[model samples]
Target: MKSYIISENRDSFLGMKLAGIQGIYVRDTADIEKAFKGALKNPEIGIIYLTEKAYLKIEDLVLESKRKNLFPLITVIPDRYGYERQQGVITQYIKESVGL
Candidate 1:
């Protein structure tokens, strides 16, 4: 159950890497798709952390994957700039799960 990160910038990538989470830096939709597909195919990867900016580009794909797979839990996290005012993906999940 290893964790991986998909970051939009080098800063975020390095930060997560320093925390011991292996990651890939993606600047476009194609790169995001590639990284996500690779992660999904790897059985050892059980958790995926995506920066908010990266997640926004592939939100539909991420949601669909989450609904279809039981492993490799996908999570969206804030980058160095911090979270947006709108609700985040994880926050939505938590609210739905606890019926809040």
Candidate 2:
């Protein structure tokens, strides 16, 4: 399966493209929802990378997808500005699951 990215900025989209991942550039809730739905429907796409800003706009949908399916794992990635200093929710989940 392939990986896809959905980002809110041109720089982030370009960066992921450089890494050989196809992506969508989103500017609003509508774009985010559209890209996300399309990616989920694609059987070849098994993972989705979303920029932090983009994910925030559709956190509920992302989480719901995670709860309902195993493929096309939705991951929130840092933007061109870089990741937040604090621990992220996924990191916390990993730590708890692994007893870290």
Candidate 3:
């Protein structure tokens, strides 16, 4: 399994690409579903890094992956625009799942 990088801007993705990331996905518009689907298709993609805002938007896809027990790890990151802590529900669920 390989790794993948997902970002909303091309500049946001360059660092990973330069580091020899085999797969990179960038969403021009605000379509999180499209980005999620694109990354999910690749069997080699073992990890997905998402900008925080984008994570909130397309988190349903992340949930589906969890339901199916897919192992591609999903991590949230801040984009150039900055970070937003708007996902209280998901955070609670994650905490509960981890027995925290």
Candidate 4:
């Protein structure tokens, strides 16, 4: 799968793409499923950094990734507002998965 970005805004998408993530920009929650599904189909996706809000909206997809053995690790990122305690989704997922 290809590394993708599920952000509500464009800045994060541009940044990720510039950072060599091959990021696909998603505009809203509805677009997330289509974009993510496409990413999951690609073999190049080793890590997917998505917005916390977006991930939460589609928590089932992320949870499914955990239940299944996949190559591209699903990660969540905070928006430009900065990381919030309840929305550090990526960290939370990792911590829960590794029991860290």
lDDT of each: 0.84, 0.84, 0.67, 0.71
- State which candidate, 2 or 4, has the greater TM-score: 2
Highest TM-score against the true fold, candidate: 1
Using lDDT as the yardstick, the better of models 2 and 4 is 2
Give model 1's clash tally: 0
List model 3 lDDT by residue over 3-97, tens digit each: 77677656667767788765445454455667677777877788878766666677766666766754677776677666666568577658534
Measured against the true structure, the TM-scores of the candidates, in listed sequence, are 0.86, 0.85, 0.67, 0.77
TM-score between candidate 1 and the true structure: 0.86
Candidate 1 Cα outliers beyond 4 Å, as residue runs: 85-91, 95-100
CA RMSD, predictions in order:
2.7, 3.1, 3.8, 2.9
Q: Model 2 clash pairs?
A: none
Q: Per-residue lDDT of 32-95 in model 4, one digit per residue for the tens? A: 8778777777777777777877777787877787567446777777787766656665677677
| Model 2 stretches with alpha carbons more than 4 Å out | 84-90, 93-100
Locate the minimum summed-lDDT window of 10 residues in model 2.
91-100
**Candidate 4 global TM-score:** 0.77
* Candidates sorted on TM-score, descending: 1, 2, 4, 3
Q: Which runs in model 4 stand beyond 4 Å of their true positions?
A: 87-91, 96-100
Comparing 1 with 4 on lDDT, the higher-scoring candidate is 1
Error of 2 at 56 (Å): 0.2
Instruction: State residue 1's C-alpha deviation in candidate 1, in Å.
Output: 1.9
Candidate 3 regions exceeding 4 Å error are 23-25, 28-31, 86-100
